[model samples]
Target: MRISLALLFAVVLQLPAENGYAQRTHVAISMNNVSVEQILNKIEETSDYVFFYNDKTIQKNRIVSVRNKSGKILDILDDIFKGTDITYTVVDKQIILSTNKMQLVQQEGQIQVKGVVKDAGGDPLIGVNVKVKDSTVGTITDINGNFSLQAKKGDVLEVSYVGYATKTVRVQNAQVLNIVLTEDTEVLNEVVVTALGIKKEAKSLSYNVQQVSNDEITRIADANFVNNLNGKVAGVTINSSSAGVGGSSRVVMRGTKSLNGNNNALYVVDGIPMSDMSAASTQPTDSYEGAGQSGDPISGLNPEDIESISVLSGPSAAALYGSAAANGVVMITTKKGREGRTSVSISNNTTFSAPLVLPEFQNTYGQTEVGSYYSWGSKLNTPSSYDPKDFFQTGVNVTNAASLSTGTDKNQTYLSLGTTNANGIIHNNDYERYNVTVRNVAKMLKDKLTLDLSFMLSSVKEQNMTSQGLYYNPLVPLYLFPAGDDFSKVQAYQRYDSERNLLTQYWPYSTSLALQNPYWITEHIKIPNHKNRYMATASAKYDFADWINVTARAKMDRNNERRERMYDAGTNTLFASKYGYYSKSNIENQQIYGELLLNINKYFVDNTLNLTANVGANFENNDYQSDYFGGKLKSVANLFTFGNVDTSEKNLANQYGYHLKKRAIFGSAQIGYKSMAYLDVTARNDWSSTFKGTNTGSFFYPSIGLSGIITDIFRCSTDIMPYMKVRVSYSEVGNSPDVFLAIPTYALVDGV
Candidate 1:
């Protein structure tokens, strides 16, 4: 008996310590306001263990707060489930979770749910997020705002949309749901994207900034989206050139600041500055002799790629951009991949356009004489059958775009492709464009280091682009055609010239040099423009501490543009030389920018006073080169190649090149008092290569602003007025001269 008792005691003593539980591993965790599922995920990630439990049996939605220093798994679980009626058991490499009162049993059935989301006004809300609460099953509303998901009964459905309040509806055995969301005006008015891609509370900003959402910018399509902003924003004016499709647009904010230089606002995309260069044009003494206006750089951007646009309309709001923002700044923010399940979206749009109004012409009078250009001739009993309306055709534009976004907790990816095909109001004039964009985001080192990389490729081709001059513009002859003339007679504008053995203009008039056969000009004269662009951006951010961080970003944007002008023989003699004229021009522009930023945010006085500061340095370089070959064609009558031009010194070609560099150091600081009042101060110093002398090359700018929330300070009812704030700012900004302005150069005379 004694020996048996001794054997039992020895075996019990030999068992594993901690009641047969093995000492697996220990972990250090500190989490606040986390969920039970998140805690288990962290544990699973840190150890070689898997968690097993019925999702329906576990209360994953319960909030948990825990802190442990090198604690064992069991001890951490105990701390996590201290007051809850839950328990866990570890066997082998799995942790089985069950309620304290009973064992967990997994459910095998799921309900299928379908729903349509709409706004309070009953308008379908596309892209609304519909998710089963606390699960990985989610979907977005399609173009028609309809969604479907597989969720069990009693599972909550969380629906959310931008600028709308979130709502959670419990599934009550209903197969279909029609949910309507209310607008959240406070959230819409509270956030604003500032200069340098910084987001801030609107009420705390010292200067005024206006925001335009993607919905507003994409509500209607235009060849030049910048024209859509006309009359939409205060203190801003937009002017679109008469050049047909893909024309240049001028945007002036506040007022003009430069007397001789460009007054157009600077454009920034995703925190990187973009070139706003426009193609050069010859100013004609009269409207009929100059080259057509070329498309602006901004016109090449796709509106579908934009997420939002913020207009810093005043110097105070654009102080950080230094000399480049003397006329204010237009900051563009693009969409990024979200942290959720994969989603794909596709959209198509078609637009029809026509002339809004046309000039009135006298049709009661015939030409003064048979072939005279004057319209003050004797009255005609039969009005002229010529109508200007017959010269213009209805324009059609079609655009298609698709985007895909997918991401995990630590990585995200986004890809987009779009195409635009459009026809102008004039015959034989059309434009086509293609664009592709890719972006990837990665988080490493426990989310302390973040990396973002993006690339964009775009191409634009314009056929028979209408120019301002009468040489290539069909409008010149279409509008000036004699009222008494039979318009259909000129439809076949080319006739065989027996002497030249070639097709020649069939016009009967010779008075005005600008007037020509419209059909002849449209078919014989060719002006084709092509532009290709590539942009790449890489940015990395490292959070060294909770209150301090640093970011380094670099970007390169390059584009090549080619334009050709060909004039066939027998065209207007004044516009084209003997045999014919052909000109080819190639322009290349490149911009490289790099920035390093230090950001700091700290709290004082028990979080009543919050302060934020940003110190950054930027380096930017721009290079532009243009090569032109222009002369009268030699030998070849219809060839449009540069090699066919006469190579003599009298018909020489010219080239031009310009290079500029800009460096800037900027700093900004903001202070807020209990989210009620705020003060902001910013300073920037720029060194421009365009300025020659040491002192003249550098400029300094500063801005200060103050804002106060009267409603918050006075304890007013928000129901009466959602928000009320007053702000005022003052700034001193400088404008740098145009490229090569400060340098001395001589033009080539006869190819000297």
Candidate 2:
């Protein structure tokens, strides 16, 4: 028949890989209806031809004797593995048995599937279309929706796509799956999670990573989850401390990377590495008015134990993290181990936060005004209901939670416990805080051992209300103080200097006879604070083969602090003690980390290789201590006196510090050459004792990158914009600090 149609058109043309795309081949047959000469004698009873290709595979396994008509069954198994190096791929009616020999092999007894395809309020449903039923096997999913398929024995699976309803799975014995897909309100897609955790397809990322999940930080837990990420990211900026809600918030992710340290970033969690310091958040803007400053140590964490948050802005999106990431990096992912069928979740939502930005102040004058009224004209007292409705504005809140999850297929677990309480709107200027948190995740030795544990406890108490200190302090008596003198009779009559441009005094509150005593400085001042904290991490990973893997990590973070400043013994004028004064402070910090890692993965299927390799070694240690004391006492009977016959002149301070950082050498590499070409290389080295001499020591940082997937090498591969990729990266991190060698040179003094 015309030489069997010219050898099936020379085995349907083929080529692609050295940085392009296509490289497919196929040959599979396991039928209940075999013809075409019993599928060419079943590929000549399993390979090894020779001998005139075994009589042309037994005279072409007859279809009425080698097609007494034409040809099919894939042109007779493409002339039996055509060019003999054996390779394959066919995504409809399954068949992928590649072998060009660049190994990363794993195959075990058919029936397999590992899934992820979300929708119904859980968002994530890409390309969906997986099949098994009615022949023509299938597969499609990637871009975070992940997928892996292979089935046999009682197949019967059919999951359609293109929108809502279509599912029919019955392979019986399941294996790791998670699919939700619901909303197709006429196709609407938007999903992104690039750089490393690879889950692209959010229009194929060009440069932008800003995902904040976990229900938008539990609906902005009363601000301070990094201040609810202020105005949501565009050029990010947030500076706080106008005395509001637990005070202190200043995060600038993409600007001012450093003019003198304090420029921030690098705060990973779960993938471990948290604690970027200059003692994180310095608070101190008058603890939101009344009560010695405090608030902003990760704002006592607990945003439902976060689930995912990425903010790796600059340094080329954190050049594989080096040099403390140079003011950029905040990757955090927590919450796991779940396979379902044992779920218990209880959540509580609460809201009551006052102050959506307000600070205008000047309600038609209250604590006195208009000739400084007490009796107008010259200067004097203040009262008249000290009105303006006593400057009104208030706020309050409370929340609670609990969780539990379970799974099977060789185990899965997640446990959670939580609590929160808050109050603030200024009056007795109240603030009360108490919190407890616990998180656990386990996946037994079957999924290859994994366990993560988290625990937290917190406490806060505050008080503020002793009235009077108004009409904007210029020295007492702002308006009506003569008629029934409110806020303690008026003192030093209205003294006015209005910027003492130094000279004159129409004293209505201030003109310098020092009209002090704003209700005796908020009645007997008092400031108190106390805190304790701990954070941890422990790890172990082992695969040892199948592309190798080994890991070991241990981490710890600790904090303890105490502060008190109280004074009361009469000082209506610089000195008039009934006897009382105080100041005390103590602080401590500790951090430690250890690590070891190695990973490698390889797969090529003919010059469309994709490789990954990583190595690690790390050790870190830090400790700091501080103490201060101040005194003076006589009698309120000595508010717990501290004296050597007290009279004022009490000062004491102590500080201790230590740090040891060590990092061994390691090399990392990633190469791709097909599947849209790419290459990435990395190297690391460090040893610091805070650096000293020859202007710094032990350093080495290397990086290189390039990517180009351009629509899978352009002849356009799609199914709703599959992937795009186009990357360029360069890296060279640095940080050698002796902090300007802690200055103190001029060694010539040795001549003594």
State residue 424's C-alpha deviation in candidate 2, in Å. 8.0
Global Cα lDDT for candidate 2:
0.52
Deviating ranges (above 4 Å) for candidate 2: 1-215, 218-223, 226-244, 247-551, 560-562, 568-579, 589-752
TM-score of 1: 0.78
Off by over 4 Å in 1: 1-187, 279-294, 467-470, 649-651, 693-695, 717-721, 750-752
lDDT of each: 0.77, 0.52
Report the C-alpha displacement of residue 76, candidate 2, in angstroms: 25
CA lDDT for candidate 1: 0.77
List model 2 lDDT by residue over 55-142, tens digit each.
1223333333222122233444555546544344332322333344511133332445546676664445655667788887677654
**What TM-score would every model get versus the actual structure?**
0.78, 0.31
Error of 2 at 29 (Å): 30
**Model 2 poorest ten-residue lDDT run:** 48-57
| TM-score, model 2 to reference | 0.31
